[model samples]
Target: MSVLAAIAITTGILSGVWGWVAVSLGLLSWAGFLGCTSYFASPKDGLKGLGLSIATNLSGVFWAMVIIHLSTWVGIDIVGYVVTAVVAFFMCIQAKHNILNYIPGTFIGSCATFAAAGDWQLVVPSLLLGGVFGFAMKASGVWLQETLNKPDTELCEEN
Candidate 1:
């Protein structure tokens, strides 16, 4: 997780230097905030975290786009908040299904999408990169735990 965060921070700084401020912010959000969410949700399982992260990020982008479009025809502020709530509700429902728990990802995705102003070109790639890096970090953590021959029961209890 530390290594993943370091990479994310470095990437954000580099992105800002390159004048991609929106992308930088999105990456920072993913690395710092969303990553924590994934960690807490899945613990030592990187693959599950990766899947959830990707799904949530993409869901956010989709919802952002929808809200943006709807705002043009309605009250922007109202639409924004309402749409967010709706997405959250649906995501929670999905989370209730054991194999389909992806609410966290949706939250991250929505944040990233809004940060990037629903720009597909920007949001899509950034989310993908963040998701992949996050996954790799979690996987590495899992590997380290296994290499140390740590008991799974102990790890679960710590979480």
Candidate 2:
């Protein structure tokens, strides 16, 4: 149920942002359902996950858009795809707690927007970046988990 809701909301945000009239509302509705479920399930963690997902994904899109808008200056012809791949990879990496499971569709959806805007060069780079991002995030996740699992009073109690 929550998974389905998350999918819908993610789709809606991407579609709506790209002005896809048919899918916008539907996606938004799903997102709303996810929000409601998150609110009830584990308020702090759920909300934190939602916020992080939005920030990371949206920021990726924004950066991609900028890359597309100034492709020539960056010496990169495939700005859209490159950005998408990088963002996708990072999304997978930053999944934090299985959150990355929601990445594929969201990535394709956002990449579609950039492609529609006439930036095809970004495709390959986006894919490569996505892989790299995933690996990096996994490392970070492990570190975070280990760090968080330590007893808080151990150091504080000594010296």
Best by lDDT: 1
Q: Write the per-residue lDDT of candidate 1 for residues 1-159, one digit (tens) a residue.
A: 344465455444543443353355554434333544443465336566666666665666776677677766687687867876776677567667544476666666677667766666666765676555555554555555454565778768888
- Ten contiguous residues minimizing lDDT sum, candidate 2: 34-43
Clashing pairs in 1: 56-105, 56-106, 57-109, 60-109, 60-110
Question: After superposing candidate 2, which stretches have Cα over 4 Å from the reference?
Answer: 1-45, 72-112, 118-159
Worst 10 residues of 1 by lDDT: 13-22
Over 1-159, each residue of candidate 2 has an lDDT whose tens digit, in order, gives: 234454454444543443342243322323322222322232223345444434433444555565556664667657756765675566466546553344533344245335546333333233223322333333344455555566778757764
TM-score of 1: 0.58
How many backbone clashes can be found in candidate 2? 13
lDDT of predicted model 2: 0.42
Cα deviation of 52, candidate 2, in Å: 0.8
